[model samples]
Target chain A: DVKVTQSSRYLVKRTGEKVFLECVQDMDHENMFWYRQDPGLGLRLIYFSYDVKMKEKGDIPEGYSVSREKKERFSLILESASTNQTSMYLCASRLAGVGELFFGEGSRLTVL
Target chain B: EDQVTQSPEALRLQEGESSSLNCSYTVSGLRGLFWYRQDPGKGPEFLFTLYSAGEEKEKERLKATLTKKESFLHITAPKPEDSATYLCAVQAGGDTGRRALTFGSGTRLQVQP
Candidate 1:
């Protein structure tokens, strides 16, 4: 089974704080994605990486950025966190051209 | 733009009851439709993938069937352990460059003992 790991399960931060969420996949998959989930809205794609040093914006990429310096590791960076940014963040990885996405446990962020 | 919608925002049933969840989608070109189970505070776990109309896939008590514009997930004799939010996602042919899926809001299921 493919394993995807998120660095944190929970975090609490104040407004204007910079936050970093990291994800790692052990299966050498070529695609990685970050999604944010809120109460009423489903998982919304924030960003995705197809290769090392490559990234692209998803539908809701505002106030978020990503880094994929290495194939197995991907990171999401929030320059300035706000109350609206507090939500559950999920990281997923998949083999190129495959239809399934293997997801990590998830990281829940709370900004006050 | 691609869109996915799930019906019955929430459902509650007895342990032995059988029920079905619906997922409707609209995309420029269909590539694949997927179902996932999401436990509270956890990321979604992939369940099944339907590539075309009339495709069906099953795992344990959960069976997923797909059509041109909709899909159905039938849960037979669900248990307390099966209580979770079921999510639906779709991959559009136009999303080859992004390699991402658009997801529905999800249906929250609770099976009472």
Candidate 2:
């Protein structure tokens, strides 16, 4: 089974703080994605990386950025956290050309 | 633009009850449709994938069926342990080479003992 690990399960930060969420996949998948799941909105893509140092904007990428310096790791950075950014964040990985995704346990962020 | 919608935002069933969840989609072209089970505070767990119409897949008490524009996940004799949110997503095909999926809001199921 593929293992996708998130650096944190729960986090709380004050408003205007910078936050970093890290994710690592052990299967060497070429595609990694970050999504925020909220009630009544499902999961909305924030960012996705297909290769090292390559990234693309998803539907809702306004306040977020991503780093993919290595093949097996993808990180999401919130430059300035706000109350609206409080939600459950998920990281998923998949092989190129495959639609199936292996997801991490998820990181829940609370900005107060 | 690709879109996915799931019916019955929430469902309540008895331990021995059987029911089905619906997923409707509209995409320029369809590559695959996927079903996932998500527990509270956890990421989704992949369940089944339907590549084309008339495709079906089963695992334990859950069976998934797909058509041209919709998919169904049938849970037979669900148990209390089966309570979770079921999510559906679609990947577009054709010139859109992107592999990212568009997901529905999901159907939350709770089976009472």
* TM-score of candidate 1 chain B vs. the reference: 0.96
RMSD of model 2 against the true structure: 1.0
What tens digits encode model 2's per-residue C-alpha lDDT throughout B8-96?
99999999999999999999778899999999988999999999999999999999999999999999999999999999999998642
The list of candidate 1 runs beyond 4 A from truth reads none
Clashing pairs in 1: none
Tell me how far the alpha carbon of residue A83 in candidate 2 is from the true structure, in angstroms, after superposition.
1.2
> What does candidate 1's lDDT look like per residue over A1-112, in tens digits?
9999999999999999999999999999999999999989999999998889988899899999999999999999999999999999999999986588999999999999
RMSD of each: 1.0, 1.0
DockQ of prediction 1 = 0.82
> What are the clashing pairs of model 2?
none
Instruction: State the C-alpha lDDT per candidate.
Output: 0.94, 0.94
Worst 10 residues of 2 chain B by lDDT: B93-102
